[model samples]
Target: MEHIVELVGRALLAFLIMMVIARLLGKQTIAQMTYHDFVAAITLGALTANLAFNVQMKIGHMITVLLTFTVIAYLLMILALKNRSLRKWISGQPTMIIQNGKILEGNMRKLKLSLDTLNQELRERNIYNIEEVQFAVLELNGEISILRKPEYLPVTRKDLKLKAGRQWFPIELIMDGKIIQDNLRQNNLTIEWLMSQVQKKGLTIAQVNYAVKSSNGQVYFDRYDDQMPNPIDKE
Candidate 1:
């Protein structure tokens, strides 16, 4: 029917318009959205939805409003970037909630960041013990940035005064029973050497579901039939 065709056309138009506007807006990630960006995003989504289904409004008028709103948001974003005070107001300043293993209850109350939320965020960053946190700041984009006490930090090779081990990048030699000829050639390996490696493990190229050769020249294999009684990860 004509109505169905019109709806389809409008939906496609909405998609194209959103794609263009998104490029113009230059949003890198939803997680990085400021308060103004968040509001603009919601407004854009609503406008696009209306453009898709609200047949009562004139399409030209609908597009005009959407484009106008986007221009205003874009201009505001540009101005926010140039002015430090405006940026601070729009994005909000990062607030420190934890310092020297002590929770700042005053900052928490002012930012309306709940203790439960703080604990959850800390756990997400693998900081199980709050007493060990050296510093924790609530970022503008609702992410918690934490610095652990030096004592709680993981030991590094430099600390032990030991040379770093050879870094070996794994190269795929076989996948889905097919030999990766390009990888073999790049790694200076031949089919004969590959077959011998497979045979050492009492398997053939046909038996391997996947295979990889480490830079250390160690070849590993995975078979088609794992014969697992119960995969622990299966829900």
Candidate 2:
């Protein structure tokens, strides 16, 4: 039990020390991390994490290791600041993943970035189609930056020279076959009125998955299972 407690205590200390070092390094150390920064962060974290639980590694040894690495990192960063070429080498240059709506196959190969990985990243950024992108850059720390074509970008009210701030909000009328009285009262709607609207869509309160009132004064309706039978029934 004492051994376990010691292990936990050492782990906590290691985490705290690393956290302080990271905070001192500033947000740019991770936010706009270069390849070297990324590698350094990971390697340091792994080393500390292992040292925390490894009984063979004393706390003094861990501190010594951390201090040594921190000094080295500080020196490297200072040198990098002084020398542009060193900075470029340490950080690496951003590779063009896509240019002019086409993938740079050579860059992709060099970076070992696969089509699937690119698509996944794009999807996370709400980009559905690759052709919609004008430029895609792979940063040194492996993050992607996308620039979409004008046509692919969502149209803002400013584009049409319109001052429209009164955006529409949807009101929840029902959820999971239960009448949301609070929402109904908030929207100045009644259960009877909601039932009448549901009937218009050939649906019942029991059959509705969600019923919502749109800002355009439209009542949007959804069935519990629109395309197929309820999966809950299968279970």
Compare the candidates by TM-score and give the number of the best one: 1
In model 2, the runs with Cα more than 4 Å from the true position are 163-235
lDDT of 1 by residue, 118-147 (tens): 999989888778987999998888788999
Model 2, 67-104: lDDT tens digits are 88877776777778899999888778888989999999
True-vs-predicted CA distance for residue 28, candidate 2, Å: 2.6
Error of 2 at 145 (Å): 1.7
TM value for model 1:
0.72
